[model samples]
Target: MIDDAENKEALTSFLQKLVNDSYEAELRRYSSLLATSSRLLTCDSIILVALSSIASLIVDGRVSISREAFIACVCVAALIGASILFSIICQWRIGYKDLASPGEQVKFVEKSWEKLSSDWNIAKSYSKTLDIMYKSVSSRNNKISVLLRISVALLGAALAILLILSLCMINRACAGA
Candidate 1:
């Protein structure tokens, strides 16, 4: 009887250790995901600020272009910037909002580990899907930011060229008269 009890206890200990180790690994992965999500949010904020600045310049008549084209560009940039901001907000709500309290996630993971010992595979699969979704959203955000930056550069260049040409035309008119 003594040997049987000892063997059972050893088995239980081994199982517990396995659960603990898996939970720790998962917790570490979640921490990394949180960090990456935060970084993406910050980058989106910076892009929005830049787009807003460009829109301001256009609204304030600094670009020296026809009202129609200026308004159109400003609208498009504003829409893209707003969409990016919205995406970041949604991702934060879905991925990181509950993780704000320190160590809460770790405790949750431990509890989950205890309850779902036999279902670790399912949990791991779900986690992988969530990670893929995060990456997809992050990639979309980066692409939109790049497009916005290119649009800003092209618009600025066009405005500058228009300004130079207008100045030349005015100079010619004055000289001819």
Candidate 2:
């Protein structure tokens, strides 16, 4: 019947648009954030590594700072490394199981269409799907954001420690000389 054809077309269009607007949009947003967060943490690690290498080389070859100051610098570098590692782990944490449930959604849509061919039930299912996917992505993003903040804070703390130790090294060397 023409009515059946029209209803099917309408349902298909609605579902497509709903997926695009809700599921795909959320996915894209989360993916972009994940990538940016990962890059930031990676850059932080690289900087920390470089700073550690430089500091070690300088302290070993040039400066004769106190043992306590040297130890503090090493501890700060270790903590920064740990924080960066945690951020990377958090960024990769996601509900992959939830993401793989499009089959369930498909079944639900089929049942809704078979029962009444009404748009209301199909729309409800689409909305529910969108909500579930959004929640999953949002939860993952929140976790990653927290880790990123912690990583940045640790990085800042490490820099502060580096500055203080460098100053101490300078003062000690000058006083001794």
Candidate 3:
């Protein structure tokens, strides 16, 4: 059992001193990135469903459109499908490294306690943990961010194609009239 004095010392040592202010800010940024990924997933899913529904309606004779426009719609739907895939991949699980399990950390400290010289250095121990976590989290973050960019780019291209196709259809309609 830990004495009251030792417990107090341990609590004080761990009080917000385990992580830097930078890391705290970085955690918020990471959370924002995850939220953005979710929004992308939602938007891509909606666009893909809408495009697919239109294509199906045209195929089933429930909707009538020019052959060129139908083909353009199908092609744009494919683009959105690809974007949806990327967004889903971005939403997949990414393992961010946290501190060691409590049991493991306690055991490590206990084993090293016998060799102690002056006192326990929580900062040094936490720094090493941060080093490992940074490497893992940063790499995962980079991959996720790249996937997000790809999804956004694909979605943009699909929208642009749809816009151009609409303009062409309008111009053709006016000329025919």
Candidate 4:
């Protein structure tokens, strides 16, 4: 009976430790997601600024921009920027929700481990669920990041084209006068 008691105590301790580790892992995953979301927001801002500058150049006659092309570019940039902003907001909320209270979770897990039979299988299952949640969040973040990068690239290319066109128009006007 004494040996059995010792074995149960050891198993309980091990299960508690596993829970603590899993909670920490979850917290780390949440933090990473937050960081990624912030990066995506910043990238979106940069794209917006570039697009605005392009618009200003065209308005001021610095770049000879075709009216239709300029309008189309603005519309496309706006759509992309808005969508990225929305995604970033959603990611932030998910990260916030997943953030674990280290002290509280540890205490809860310890209590549960003490009361429950030393079942490693239960702890393993919980850890697996946590892993799945982390992966899903990470995948969503990656998709948004990719979209932001593509939008930034498109905005940059459009700006360059506008600048060149504006310069050409100025040259033609000067020659004509």
**What is the number of backbone collisions in each predicted candidate, taken in the order shown?**
0, 0, 0, 2
All candidates: CA RMSD (Å): 10.7, 5.0, 5.7, 6.9
The prediction achieving the highest lDDT against the true structure is: 3
| Residue 48 displacement (Å), model 4 | 1.0
| Candidate 3: residue 96 Cα off by (Å) | 3.3
The positional error of residue 124 in candidate 3, measured at the CA in angstroms, is 2.4
Q: Model 2, 1-177: lDDT tens per residue?
A: 225767767876776687667767767777777787787677777878786677877668874546797688677878778777876776775664264467975776666667536565555555665677678777777777687778777777877887888788788779989
**What shift in Å separates residue 102 of candidate 1 from its native position after superposition?**
20
User: lDDT value for candidate 4?
Assistant: 0.62
* Candidate 1 local lDDT, 51-164, one digit each (tens): 578668867978655565565555545654554554454344233222224486566657667554533333443355345544554554455445444544544454454466
TM-score of each: 0.40, 0.69, 0.78, 0.51
lDDT of each: 0.53, 0.71, 0.76, 0.62
Using lDDT as the yardstick, the better of models 1 and 3 is: 3
User: How do the residues 98-133 of candidate 4 rate in per-residue lDDT, one tens digit apiece?
Assistant: 535789767767777754344554555556656665
Lowest lDDT 10-residue stretch of candidate 3: 114-123
Query: Which of candidates 3 and 4 reaches a greater TM-score?
Result: 3
Compared with the true structure, the alpha-carbon lDDT of candidate 1 equals: 0.53
Q: How close is candidate 3 to the true structure, as a TM-score?
A: 0.78
